[model samples]
Target: MAPFPYLAWVAASTVLVPFASRSETAKLARADVPRSRAREKLGFATGQRDATQPLVWFHAASVGESLSVLALITRIGAALPDTQFLITSGTATSADLIARRMPPRCQHQFAPLDAPGPLRRFLKHWCPDAAIFVESELWPQMLRRTHASGARMALVNARLSTDSVKRWQQMPATARYMLDVFDLILTQNDAMAETIVSLGAPPARVARGINLKSMADPLPVDHAALAEAQTALRNRPVWIASSTHQGEEQSVLKAHQRLLRRWPDLCLILAPRHPARGQEVADLITEAGMSHSRRSAGDAPAGQVFLADTLGELGTWYALSDIVFLGGSLRPIGGHNPFEVAHSGATVLSGTHVTNFAETFSGMEELGAARFVSDAADLAEKVEALFSDTQGREMACAAALEFAQQQTDKLDEIAARLITTLELSA
Candidate 1:
């Protein structure tokens, strides 16, 4: 195999590691260690080796991708009682979430940096029997070195955006070299399967599967917290704008303003996509003349908006609201997961730009499980209508829940393929 470009990548990454180790994101990822103690922070050493048992390693990009792999891991692990699973992710948030959510016989670790030296230490120690990469987190050196170690590799839930395809087309050999490393390539849809093959993945190796996120159970909720929030907002009409981006918050606040005119005691729950931006979102609520309380500050909703500025608690917010508008769709940030809302048995709503989840949203729209809004004005209208019409809210919630339920058979299909590939008879 012509792996020269990957060799070049390893060499270049060696020089970049120093800078990467010091970045704010990296600091968080590496557990807030100082740059002077870089080696300890970056997960260069894999602490222990267990070579006797078959080990399957799965790498996911971030929190979303990491959570998506849970059902697949659970199914496979149950079938292959002798096998163990290791999940590695780059972000601290993903690691924290995985710690709580990973199934029995599954372990979580911070992924080693893709630089050759750390990659070598990581691969040599883990000595995984198989490697599964999720979504689009294909690091060249990581791929080349792991494949060279004789591990069977597969890329599952693969997606190549239009921009990614264009870039891969410019460098065909490099693309093929990376794609060829995978024994199997499972795309999120038929179109993505076609796109990957066109970008040089062998046609025989590529097949389409449902987006794994569709199978994820509703994000876990703290029942006590849910009960507390329920008690706090007793008999109040509540709506949520979840995972809201910067520009979209204004739209949400504006929609809340409109909704308040009709339902004067209307409670708006605003959760930003990033917890770090909680203060900013709080500031926006202030500027919009809305009274609010911040979740991170141990305050309950004293006014119009309840700022859910905490991480990994979306499940609580989803449970508390019947009318849910998923954020990131209002602007061009594509969208966040709509399945999570549906799985929570809430009526899902979104704005026009939902290309990130286009197929899923289209199917929901067809089922009358979700509503699409054109802008802030449209969002307000939809929210107001859902709140006023009790029968409409109940019907929409039931449809959304049914739509989520119907996708599980697709998850069973994916589990069957994984079982076959892993030689786990079930």
Candidate 2:
């Protein structure tokens, strides 16, 4: 609103975008985009569109954010049967996931680079009637351009971490300018709503919304792969340390080594957060004198460790194991979503530093759905007990499943509010 102060940043980014696009093209063979997609990300399908139809655009930062919006998108699509939807995300992985799951009348594209030139091209081509941004993807150029074009905009499931709030607080003018662009702001929690209002979002337009990430469908599974992994393991006690970061994998492997003493036939499925680091994790397994197989190399569980390093098959591994220790928590990485693992029917385990989903984990703990471990030794102890205690594991699994299912009512409430905000029922 106050003459968005990002012109200089946009000007510089516009000049450098071409070189950045080339660098990104080189990472096309890689799973996640390197430094997010640049100019090349503006490409969208030339699908036929009725000129009379209203088009709503949804932009999400990456795979998790993209998937979180699917249920909301589906509900909105069902209500506005004549409207078309364009879903844009910043990563190739999100694009791939959206491609497989996007409902009818919806399409996926890599989000435009948040530079003036690319943003203008993207706005001109799509000329979206309304925009909904998921999570914290606050690209100044994109938001300003969309607002200037007179499109209705909303920020849904808005979450601003303490770190992000501190960063925004340092640039009050810029933060206010960005916050004022949204016609509506639905935050992930009341605290987030308060933060948004404090940062200059109109208080009348901001309110607490349930975390849509919790409403995401369980990650999709390849049934054949799941069955194969299940048969290969032959009913042996299996557990997964999913979405592990660099240093976190070492801890997981060490825990597996310790657990092996008590359960010789135990299977540890290690899934790194970044699949590109598959080789690095495999080397760690080798150095520890453990036989391992790499999933990216098309290897199965012919050894003690099954390296689930391939992209987009977490559902299979979640299905293959009853006990799952979510990894990013072990290090200070803020942890990955354990609810998703729970949705896939696994009892969840996490490390102590789960700041990312502290509230969610706290609720789960109260419900007896998840366990916390302080270190590798604690992790090994808890994992072994879960494997041995069938009753305890089953009860946790049931509680987690119940918690995931309860998220739908929240989705329904958000969908109703979104319809009102977008004036879709008009």
Candidates' C-alpha lDDT = 0.83, 0.82
For residue 323, give model 2's deviation from the true position in Å. Answer: 0.8
Clashes found in each candidate (C-alpha, N, C closer than 3 A): 0, 0
Q: What TM-score do all the candidates reach, one by one?
A: 0.93, 0.91
**Over the full model, what C-alpha lDDT does candidate 1 score relative to the true structure?**
0.83
Candidate 2: clashing pairs of residues: none
- Model 2 lDDT per residue over 1-426, tens place: 354457677777878887766665665546544333433464433444456888889999878899889888888887788888889886777777788788778987677777766677677788888899999999888888898998889999898878999988888889989988887899878888998999888899998887777677778888998888878889887889888888888888889999999989888999998898988998999999999888988877768999989878888888887789998897788777877877887788898877767777887888888999988899999998887889998999999988888776788788778878877653
Model 1, range 1-426, lDDT digits (tens) per residue? 565776777788899987775673466735663343345335554345466678888999888899999888887787678888889887777878888887878887778788877788788778888899999988887898898999888899898778888988888899998998888899888888988998889898899877887678668899988888888888788899999888899988988898889888889989899989998888899999999988999876557999999988899888888889998898888887888899999989898888778888988989888999988899999988887789988999999999998987788778778667645443
Flag regions of model 2 displaced more than 4 Å.
Answer: 1-4, 13-48, 161-163
Segments in model 1 whose C-alpha atoms lie over 4 Å from true places: 1-3, 22-26, 29-43, 46-49, 424-426
The residue-level lDDT of candidate 2 at 142 comes to: 85
Model 2 residue 227 lDDT score: 83
